[model samples]
Target: MSNIRHHPKTETLAAFAAGRLDEARAVVIATHAAICTECAQAIEEFETVGGAFLEDAEPVALRDDALENVLRRADPGVNVVTPQKPAGDLPETRLPLSAYLEGSIDDVAWRAVAPGLSQSVLKAEGYRPGVLRLLKIAPGVRMPRHSHKGEELTVILRGAYKDEIGDFAVGDLADLDAGDTHTPEAIGDEPCICLIAAAAPLRFKTVLGRIVQPFIGL
Candidate 1:
């Protein structure tokens, strides 16, 4: 049985099923679905409903010159390219994020964010003014107290952490919005590694955090 206590909202899951979420948010949801059977089942149901809706929808008429324009844009000499899969040696925790990361988790060049805390920012194509990162916190280290400007989604990949909401272990997801504020402390013997996506910049409660926020671009 899974120890996950928190999950993405139903609306978020539905959006993911319909491909309405941004790439960063979608990756976080995919990582959570990889371990949470309940959320995974919910996603399947949402996808089924979406498929039904599509099947029942009325078809739209195309513009008079649509076909001709499409044909003219098609180049017979152009080759279709398929994306290559990541190497088999990649860690399971990072497999869902392989397309974004150039290498495995161990290969990431981490930058120190604070004492005992480091982060590796991930770049998503076409996503701007949003945040996606992998955070590594040493055991017993606490993150700076903060709240979100928008929404924040975090999925624990290894080790564990405790926040105001609850304890989160491997595969557990913590979904927080602007209304929530808390400091997460890494627990257990190993370093806690988590994948996070944020819709907006964070609002730190402390002066020191605010001072460094501009520099870190958080």
Candidate 2:
């Protein structure tokens, strides 16, 4: 049995199935679905419906030389790019995050953001200004209170955390927006590892947090 308590919204899943979400957000949702069977099944269902819709839609005529142009573009002279396999030795969390991690979680070189809190930023090619990171919070540690500037998505990779919303364990996703606010505290003996993606910078409530926010680039 799984202990997932939070999930991406139905519309978000549908957007993901339709290939409509931004790359960063999509990766977050995909990672969550990898660990949550219930969400995975839901995404599959949405994909099925999407396929049916595509099949039922009428086809549009293309340019007269469309096929010829495509063939010409595919010529040997043109660069043939091959997809690169994800580089990592992390336990298959069943997520599409390996490519970004580049190595196992243990291999990550985390930087201290504050006492008991460390973070490693991840870069996604098309996502700029949006924050994508791996956060490691020591057991029984409470993160500084803060609210988001935009939407924030967090997928727990290991351990658990408690906040105003509720307790989040492995495979659980916390979806928060600008209007939401909470202080998350790590629970249990081990550190809580989470993959987090945010649309904008966070607004820390305390003076110390605000002072260090720029340096940490959170």
Candidate 3:
């Protein structure tokens, strides 16, 4: 049995395996799958099924430049990044996310969003109507109650938090859609840091959240 209590839904995982998810959301799933055996196995199964479908499909002529395009994309210099050690109290970041950071997680330039909360927004080329960011919450800090407009994927990197849905720890992924809503609060002595990918703007329930939402861009 795995220790992780939260994971992406089957439909979400299937989209990830099929390469249909945007880069912002795909990074979250990949990072979770890196530490979660169950999700990883499920993703492998989906890939196998997809492969079977591909094998049965009719072959099509490829563009003359397709081979060159593939080789260029596959080149290590263009697509590969070596992993580095995390500094200070930050948890080890998996490969999918490590490629984006310049150094350790501690080195990230975080901007204060609210009391006891800080965030660092990440840029994803061609990703629209969505945002990927890292949020660090101090222990006992409660995030605003809110629901999603489209979909949201969050993976814990360090410490833990509790919400209406359930308690979340390191490697746990909270996969939520428009219908789900919750306010999460950091629980442990250490700060709770998570990588979040939101497909659309969040719907804040409280006046404070609404007022602050524009500034924080959550």
Best by lDDT: 3
TM-score of every candidate relative to the true structure: 0.85, 0.85, 0.85
| Candidate 1 collision pairs | none
lDDT of 3 by residue, 4-66 (tens): 999999999999999889888998999999899899999999999999999999999899999
lDDT string for model 2 (5-112, tens) is 899988888988998777777888989988888999999999999999999999998999999999898998867788667444555523588778756777788999
- The residue ranges of model 3 lying beyond 4 angstroms of the native Cα positions read 61-94
Ranking according to lDDT, highest score first: 3, 2, 1
How many backbone clashes does every candidate have? 0, 0, 0
Q: Which regions of candidate 1 deviate over 4 angstroms? A: 61-83, 90-94, 125-128
- Clashing pairs for model 2 are none
